[model samples]
Every structure is written in C-alpha cells, then in structure tokens.
Target: MFFLIWLVLFLVVVSFLLLLPASWHRAIYERYSGGRPVACPENQQPAVVSIDVRHAAVAVMDGRPNLRLSDCTRWPERSKCNQECLSQAIQAEPYKPGEVKAGRKQIYHLPVLLAAFAAWYVGAIWHSHYMFREQWLQAVGLTHAQVKQIVWWLSPHLLTAGVCLLFAYGVAWLLAVSHRKGVLQGVLMSVLLCGALIATTWFGIARLPHDLFLIEAGYIALASLTVGALVGGLYDRLVLPSQ
Candidate 1:
C-alpha cells in the first residue's frame, strides 16, 4: 500500500512538472497572438508571420523551443518556402519561457545525489524515536515488533532512499527543462511538487487516521523542500560553477 501510494505521488509530480510549464509557456507566447512582422528570407520582403506557440511550448520540454510558421503573409503563394524567417522572429524575441539552453541541459549528479541523501536522512529523523516515531507508530497502529516482523527483500529505509533519489531526479529534470536556476527557483518547484503529493494524501483522509495523515504529509513537505533547495540552490552556487 505504501509503495502504491508513492508510485501514485511520483506520477502526480511528473504530470505537474510537464503540464504546468507547457500551459504557462503557451500563455506567455500569447504575446504573438496577432502575429509579428518579419522579413521574408527569399525576397527580403516584409511579411507578417504567425507561430505555432502550442507546439513550441511542448517542444521546450525536450530542450528546444521549436519555432514554426502556422501562417504567413506570403502564404498560399510562397508558403512552401523554408522558414528561414524563423531566425528573424527568434532574434526579435530571443528568450521563450521554459526554453532550455544547450549548456544547461547537462544534469549535475552531485547535487541530485546529495539532495536525495539529505531527504532520506530527514525522513529517517522525522520518524525516529527522538522525534515523532512514537506518535506515528500510534497513529498507524503499528508496534515496533510488528514492523520488525514484516519480511521483504528490501528494507523500508532502502525503499524510502530509492524513492527520495527518484524524486530528486524528477525535481532536477523539471528545473533543467525550465532553465531555472537559483535557490528560490528550486524551492518554488519543490514546494509545488510537494503540494501535489499532499493533494494525493488528502484523497485518503477518510481511509487514514488524522494523525497519521498529518505526520506523513508533514514529512513529505519537509523532505521536498530539502531536496529542492539542495538541488536548485546548491547546484547553482557550488556544483555548477565548478563544472
């Protein structure tokens, strides 16, 4: 059941990262709604051109924002001409929201690994006897002996570490795709992903005890923030500069 819940949360995080940015990019690109003026490459004639913003936004996730002409003033007559004018349109507005630059596409492994370890450590502490372990055990109605009795090829801690690692990777991927850097950007993205996890938790409110829900939700929130800050901020200030 726990693994199932984690799997669902992972899917939710991925969906949020992918869909949100595409929607945002589409909105930002709406500035080109009426079309922009560009010089036709073939005849050097001035013409109005419309861009396929939706495709561009979706393409941004793949590290390149595709620029294609949906309609042009020279269309029907010269529509088949290569979109050499795309260069001019790009020059007019060089930056697009969520557009990942070639240099920023490389994923820094150190920060992601560190963030995962940190998140897993935080989870360990959160559920330790020194902290809320007693309350959590009570909330879940599980005794330490009962927990020890469970048999599996992988220990629960190992599974948690694995999940944390995957989650950090997901966060890093989103940051890379969006061309976002700095601690603030990392924290913001992490918080958004954490919110998605919390939403899934909320759906089980009726099936779970209130205390258990609170404990699980709180831990997830803290772990997410830790992962985000480390991957986002640490990578920008420390690891990225060294690379």
Candidate 2:
C-alpha cells in the first residue's frame, strides 16, 4: 500500500513538473515586461524604451525618443524639446531589461555532497525525535517492530543520504535550467518542486491519514528549502563565477 501510494504520487508529480518550464518562461516574461504599459507623463516627449538584458528590468528613458535636430526644432520651447534634452538623451544609458541568462550546468560536488548530508541530518532529526516520529508511526498503523524492520531493510543512513543526494542534484539542475541563482531563488524553486513532487502525491492519494501526510510533507518541504539554500549559495559562490 505504501509503495503503491508513492508510485502513483511520483507519476503525478513528474507530469506536473514537466509542464513547469513553459509556465516558468511566461512568468519571467511578465516580470520583464511589467505586464502593462506605463501612463505617459504630461509635458514630456515620448519615452524611449530599451531592454537591459542583464538585470531583467525595463528602462523607460524619459523625455527622449529617437530624435533628429529637425524633429526637436519643429517642437520649440513649448514642446519641452531642446538641445539640452537631446544631449541628455544621447548620454543616457538605454533602459533595456536584461535577457534571461541560462543557468550553468556545472555542479560543485563538495558543496552538493555536504548539502545532501545536511538534508539527511535534518530529516532524521525532524522525523526521529524533533517532531513527528510517534504520531506518524501511530497514524500509519505501523508497530515499533514493523517500523524497525522496515528501517533495517531500507537502511536509514543509506536511504536518507541517497534520496537527499538525488534531490540536491535535481534542485541544482532545475536552477540551471530556469536561469536562476541565489539562496532565495533556490528556496523558492525548492518549494515549488517539493509542492509538485511530494505534496501533490500526499494530497492526491488520500489513502494516508491527514496527519501522516502533513507530517511527512512538512519534513520534505523543510528539507528541500534548507538544501536548496545551501546548494544555491554554493553554486553562486563557487560554480557561477567559473561559468
């Protein structure tokens, strides 16, 4: 029953995540565009717009449009068009939003390995004694002996380490593909991935008790957030510069 629930959940989450790239692109596009035009200011020449392509901000070069001396001369003083304004426009940097740079594929192995261990440690502590051990086991209707037997078969250290390592790799790859870097970015990405990957399964299956799902899902979310931060920081500091 446990395996069946997990398998179904995995399939569903994978499907959802596969569709995430298109949604992510749209989000980035909207962010850059400000999703709307700004109201034009009074007594000013039409603004010149440009894409920054690095910081992802749209810059409106105010009081300046591509102009020739003939264009400004015709407008005169009343039009707010003058030689000074034209010179200012010439000197001003274009307000163009930066393009979305792709994330680098390189992984700094040491940091990711350390992060994976940290994730496993957090999960162990959180599940074993810190938060949800007794309540979860009881909710799942598993006895102490059965729990021990399962742990023995799965091998706690190996299972935790292996899964966390895989998760770290996936998170790093996602960050690269999404062209995002930084601890905060990582945390957000991890939350989205965890929600789609783990929470979806728990909610959709409905076979597990609510408490059990909550306990397990909460731990997964926490672990993903912390691990993402660590990996993101490492990638920015170590890997990003090289690329």
Candidate 3:
C-alpha cells in the first residue's frame, strides 16, 4: 500500500529524469542539420581537425569517420568539380555536421551511483540501528523507547534519500565541469559547492538548524555535490571534448 505507492512514484520520476538528457541531445541534433549545407560564417575558416594517437584505442572505438579537409592542398586527391564537396566533407569529417555524439568509450555510471548509494545508506542505517538497539540499550543514559523515539524522529531513511539525491547531483555536476581533473578539481569543486550551499542557506530559506546533527547533514549534502562534480569532471575529461 503505502510502500507500493512510494515505489511506483519513485520509478516514474527516475524514468523521466533518465530520459531527459538523451532527449535533449536528440532535439539539439535534429534542429540544425536537417539536410541543409552547414554554413561557416564569413569570419570562420573551415575546420582543422586532429586526434590523439596516444589514445588510439578510444579514438578507434569511437567510430566516426576521419574528417576530410575541404581544401585538398593537403590531400593528393582533388578535382575542380569536387572542391565544394571536399570542403563540405572536411567539415563533416569524423563527426557528421550537427551530429554531436558523446564519445566512443563508455564508463558506466549506474554501478558507481548504486555502489555509493548503497555504501552511504548502509553506513547511516548501521549507525542508527546500533545507536538505538545496542549502544543506547546498554547505556543507563537512554531508555529503549527513548532511543527508538530519537531514531524515528530523526528519520534516517529520509536523510538517506536526501543524501542520495545529493550524490546524483554531484556525479552529474562532476561530469559537466569545464576544466581540471582528479584531486585538484575535486578539492576545488568541493570547496565551491560547500561554500555555495552554506552561503545560500544563509539567505534564510529553510529553517536554520540549531543542532549539530542537521548541520552535519547539510555539510554532507554540500560534500556530495562537490564529489559529484569531481566525478563528472573526470568523466568529461575522459569521455567528452575538452573546451
């Protein structure tokens, strides 16, 4: 009943969110390249393309054709009749005009997301369970009912869900970073995101927590966003073109 309805709603939200990026890419490709000749603005020269031979494996797997230079002053093959076609093709080269694809290589993120989600949840639940059942039960400090009440009121499950969403956002942001990689980028992004979260909170949107616990939760969300951005930046370095 209640659980079933919750599951259904979660599934619906996830499905729609998952489809959004792919649909966005599709719309972008559809609009510009509707079989018309791609025009380079007067100031813009034709493209000069190159690939990294060091990462040849990735390049090969990424399967778009090599771009042909329109000005065949470089290539031995040329014709007066075919210069425009050659020029058009040079523009087309490895990637078709207006058809921007993600990458030849794939590092699946679902497993990473799932693993992080599981690890965080497990840690949080174990902490709550031990606090309520074993630790609090043995201590003269808190009665069993009191321990249960604390855990129930704090709602570890809701906190975990919030952390998970933060994780998702962090990973997505990491893959979207414009520059930098590895620890440097991670550290910087963490700093920026945490700062943003804290600074934004000061604007007086949500009720400020007077307690240490929720202050930590807010920090955790901030950390998650930073980590997510780091992951995303690294992935972009590997999978997307560097700007």
In candidate 1, the residue pairs with backbone N, CA or C atoms under 3 Å apart (3 or more residues apart, or in different chains) clash, namely none
Q: Write the per-residue lDDT of candidate 2 for residues 108-167, one digit (tens) a residue.
A: 666578779889988878878457889988888888888778776756678779989988
TM-score per candidate, chains pooled: 0.54, 0.52, 0.36
- CA lDDT of each prediction against the hidden true structure: 0.75, 0.61, 0.45
The root-mean-square deviation over C-alpha atoms between each candidate and the true structure, in angstroms, is 20.2, 21.1, 21.6
Candidate ranking (TM-score, best to worst) = 1, 2, 3
- The candidate scoring highest on TM-score is 1
Candidate 1, residues 22-112, lDDT tens digits: the string is 6778674764443566878787876766687766766665566776877665553465688988877755643344433223344677899
Off by over 4 Å in 1: 1-104, 148-153, 237-243
lDDT of 3 by residue, 63-113 (tens): 432222222211111112233443443345354544534222233354336
Q: Candidate 2: which stretches are off by over 4 Å? A: 1-103, 154-157, 199-204, 238-243
Number of residue pairs clashing in candidate 1, backbone atoms closer than 3 angstroms, sequence gap of 3 or more or interchain: 0
| Residues forming the 10-long window of minimal summed lDDT in candidate 1 | 94-103
Let me know the TM-score candidate 3 reaches against the reference structure: 0.36
